[model samples]
Target chain A: MIEVINLRKSFNGQEILHGVNLKVNDGQSLALIGGSGRGKSVLLKHIIGLLKPDSGKILIDNEDISKLRGRKLKRLKERFGMVFQGGALFDSLTVFENIAFPLREKTRMRASQIRKTVSEELAEVGLSGAENKYPAEISGGMKKRVALARCLVMSPEIILFDEPTTGLDPLIGKAIHTMIRSCQKSYKFTSIMVTHEIPDIFSMVDRVAMLYNGVIHAEGTPEEIQTSKDPVIHQFIHGELEGPISIN
Target chain B: MIQILTLLRIIGAFVIFVIRETGRMGIFLAEAIFWIPFPPYLFGRVVRQINFIGVKTTLVILLTGTFTGMVLALQIYFTLSKFGAESRLGPIVALSLIKELGPVICALMVTGRAGSALAAEIGIMRITEQIDALDTMALNPYKYLIIPNLIAGVISLPLLNFIFVFVGVWGGYSVGVGIMGLSSGTYFGNIRDFVTGADILEGLYKSLSFGMLITWISCYKGYFTGYGAEGVSKSTTQAVVLSSVTILIWNYFLTSILVA
Candidate 1:
């Protein structure tokens, strides 16, 4: 379980996340939805200890990950799997090497074992023969899948996805969505995915939370979010350009 | 009074910028030092970087060293002929190549070639969030990305300097004894008699220091690159310019101290 209390972050004296509080129960899939640049990704980065909050408490499994440092922080990070908005695969490394990176770094597994594990993960991600391709040579959707395979190879206790399906076609996005749904069902890792995907992701995730004005404006099941009376939530969910959200 | 105040403000800002960058670099260096002895030392990466920095750069260094020595021999031979001291050209060219030009020019070349690439590569990684990915994987970016390059620079520069000196001395020999009609016996004898072990050691010392400086500046720039393609370009430019300027400045001081 993860608990974030009063998380606040600012860049260049402009506050992005202001006194935001949220929680994710163990083994649950939560969708953090927001308008573009509303700090949803920032919140995910905070959860993974990639970006520290200016003022907040991030309790991961009851331990304050915010206060962890060096070795302690590294240990805390081992619990996390983050798929960045841009696949963020090491451009210098091939798909196989990238997927095997964490395992090689953190464990003493033999070469045969690593190859087997990487092969299995690739098969799971449906990227069996794409192992030798570099990140630049692959398609964007394929890169994201590779990133997912890399993230899953570690078998992290928690997973954070930042706009996973942002740049893909509808068909490819659906494929990625299916992959995520199946993997989540099997791995059952606590997942927090930040996306503005409508209808499709709404059905995939168990719960939806909307962030507005530096705080979670609404939280409930997707049906509850879809039917909320708040004009902001309605406007956002239906992709309307009017209501409380200013286009300026 | 307003002019004075504006000048003071500019000076203050410059001072603060210097302090901030210095502190950041110091902390980065300390982190690299701390993680160097830890497990999973990346020998393969270090070797690869050495090949990139040293072996791949052999032709450029050779060309620069040979041309520089050839020119020095030609000019010095003419100056020496004015005083009927043409044989002295051998010791002058040999000493200059061994004690100064070989290391300084070789370092400058490598800085332009490898240092800029290092900065740009790391800066691209930073912008693409690969550094953050490393952090998420429970890996220290400093240990994984930086230590190998640093070790490679430190090791490769001295070896490159040795090659430069060897090629440069031969260049001077070819030009002075072969091209300029000086007696080969006189040229070889003068160098053998006048040049000492300390001259070669001076070049090694300068190369060692220069290697550390170039890698440090380049890596620091890349590691702290701002954002985007523009940021990567800026960091690469800054790394090359700063490392080159620092090498020249530090060379003057080192020469004064070493020679004194």
Candidate 2:
């Protein structure tokens, strides 16, 4: 389980997150939705200890993440896998090596075992036989698949996805969503995804939280969020220009 | 009075910026040094970087060393002959190459070739979030990305400096003995008499320190790169300029201390 209490973050004297509170129970998938530049990624980074909040307590499995230091923080991080917006695949390594990277660096597995494990992961992501190709040689969608495969290879207890489908085509985006959903079922890890996929994302996630003006504007099941009458939620979900939520 | 106040403010801000950046660099150096002894030692990566920083840089070092030596011999012979001190030409050329020119010139060249590339490569990784990804994966970015380069820099520079000096001495011999009509025996004899072990050691020390400075500045710039393609390019430029300038400035101090 993860809990964020009264979280706040500011950059260059401008506050982006203000006393925001959120929680995700173990084995649940939560989709964080917000307008552009609403600090969705910032919040995700804070939760994963990538960015420290100006004031807040982030509890992961009941331990305060912000208070953890050095080896402890590293140990905490080992339980996490984050899929970045750009896949963040190591450009120098081939697809196989990228997926096998964590295993090679952190584990004592033999070469044959690593190869077997990587092949299985590639097969899971439907990236079979694409092992030798570099990140540049592959399509954006393929890169995301490789990123997901790499993340899953660790079997982390918690998974964070930062705008995973942002730049892909609709079909590819949907395929990625499906893959995440299937992987979540298989891995049973706590999941938080920052995305803008709207109603389509509703089908995959158990809960939806809308962030507005540096706060959680609303939080509920996907169905409740979809049918919400809150003007901010409605305006955001309907993609309206004029509403309680002002556009800059 | 207001104009003076404004000027003071500008100077104060610049001073603070310099102090802050120096402190940051100091902290960066400390952290890099701290991780040096920790294991999961990546020997293969170190070897690869040495190949890039040292072996591949050999030809440029050789070419520059040769020309520099020839130029020095020609100029020194002309000046020395006017004073009837032409016998000193060989020792002067050997001393200059071994004590100063070899380390400084070789370092500047490596800064251009390998140091800039290291900055740019790591800058791209920073902008693209590969470093962050490594952190999330429970891997230390310094261990994987930095320490190897640091080790390579320390290991490669001294060897390359030796090559530069050796090639440069022969280059001076070719000019002094073959072209200037000085006795080969006199040229060789002068170098043997005047060049001490301490001079060679001083050169070694300069190269080793230069290696550390170049990689340290380059890695620091890249590790803290701002945001995009523009950020990467800016970091790369700063890395090269800063490393080269620092090498020259640091060489003066090192030479002063070593000579004393």
Q: Candidate 1: lDDT of A115?
A: 98
For model 2, chain A alone compared with the true chain A gives a TM-score of 0.99
For model 1 the TM-score comes to 0.97
Q: lDDT, candidate 2, residue A158? A: 98
**Native-contact fraction for each model?**
0.94, 0.81
Prediction 1 global C-alpha lDDT: 0.91
Residue-by-residue lDDT tens digits, candidate 2, B204-237: 9999999999999999999999789999999999
Q: Tell me each candidate's i-RMS in Å.
A: 0.6, 0.6
By DockQ thresholds, what CAPRI class is model 1? high
Instruction: For candidate 2, give the lDDT of residue B107.
Output: 96
True contacts kept of 2: 0.81
| Tens-digit per-residue lDDT, B57-83, candidate 1 | 999998998888899998888898999
Top lDDT: which candidate number?
A: 2
lDDT of 1 by residue, A70-104 (tens): 77888889989999999999998999999999998
